[model samples]
Target: MIAREWKCRVPEAHAEGFTAYLYETGVRDSSATPGFLGAQIFRRPLIGKIELTLVTYWKSLDSIKAFAGEDISRARLYPEDEVYELEPDVDVQHYEVIEHGFIPGGL
Candidate 1:
């Protein structure tokens, strides 16, 4: 499996709204694409801004290309992003999933 990671920052006040928007955009769009394995969204509270990271799992690079187009390194953005004062990364990172599993009794 392959993992594609993207990150962005938004003001603390916009965190909630942005999260919902993400689900509607990135998450929903990726979920519908073929070869999309799964996705995880993470948020960290900073001093005054919130950092959000999205890690999407895919079956292969070709599968990713189907979703991200020819340039898989670029981060996909939605038109509504500016409404949340989003500070987004222009590029995304890709990695090969070497090991993955859940520990028993661990959340």
Candidate 2:
């Protein structure tokens, strides 16, 4: 099992919009792709520093490459994200899963 990670920073004002963009663009698209196991987004905010992290589980690097293309680095920006951060750069990191668990959502 593997979890791919990407990191970036954007202004707090653009946070919501950025999240919306992730859903519309990345989450929706990547989840639908083959070999896409799952995806999670995390945010870390400080007094004047904010960082956004996107973590995705994939079968393998080959699986990710198949969906995202040859140069698979950079956040796929949706039209909506333009209103948020002026520019977003993606730094990629891949991790091997040590352990994982999940609980069913009951409503």
Candidate 3:
């Protein structure tokens, strides 16, 4: 499994709306993609900024490339994202998931 993460900082006032937009767009689209396993969003509120991390799981790098294009490390952006005043990282990080497990029906 491949773990991919992208980070960005948003103005406090716009953080909530931006998170919603991400879920409605990126997360939603990713969920429907082939080889996409899961996605999670993490957030930390700073004094005047909100730090957000979008994490996604993929079956392989090739799957990621299908979603992110030839340069899989590059961050993907939408035109509407400018409204949130996001300062996004230029590249995303990917890691090889060494170990992970979940109990069936635990939720």
Candidate 4:
């Protein structure tokens, strides 16, 4: 499995709008993608800023490539993102899954 993670710094005022856009735009598309397993979005609120992180699971590297293009290491922002993130510090990360755990104790 492959993990695709993105960290973004968004303006405090646009947090809600940006979060809404994220889910309505790329995430909705990604969720329906063939290799998409799951996605989690995180938020950390500060006095005047906010930090957002998106982590998504993919079945394989090829799946990631199809979603992110050949330059997997590169980061890009959606054009609609500009309305919320005036200055976005975005980062895309890739991880190699070594192992996964099961419900040893049961749910």
lDDT of each: 0.97, 0.75, 0.92, 0.80
**lDDT (C-alpha) at residue 55 in model 2:** 88
Residues 2-26, candidate 4: write the lDDT tens digits: 8888888777888888888889866
Per residue, candidate 2 scores C-alpha lDDT tens digits across 1-107 of 77878776778787777777777878888898889999999988956546778889999878888767766664455575556664456557778898998677944
Q: Which order, best to worst by TM-score?
A: 1, 3, 4, 2
Model 3 segments beyond 4 Å from truth?
102-107
Q: Between candidates 3 and 4, which one is better according to lDDT?
A: 3
* Total backbone collisions for each predicted model: 0, 0, 0, 0
Top TM-score prediction, candidate number: 1
Residue 29, candidate 4: Cα error in Å is 2.0
lDDT of 1 by residue, 4-77 (tens): 99999999999999999999999999999999999999999998999999999999999999998999999889
Worst 10 residues of 2 by lDDT: 82-91
Q: Name the lDDT value of residue 28 in candidate 3.
A: 87
**43: Cα error in model 4, Å:** 0.5
Q: Output candidate 1 Cα RMSD.
A: 1.1
Model 2 lDDT, full chain set = 0.75
RMSD of each: 1.1, 3.1, 1.9, 2.7
Which pairs of residues have clashing backbones in candidate 2? none
Q: Provide the TM-score for each candidate, comma-separated.
A: 0.96, 0.78, 0.91, 0.83
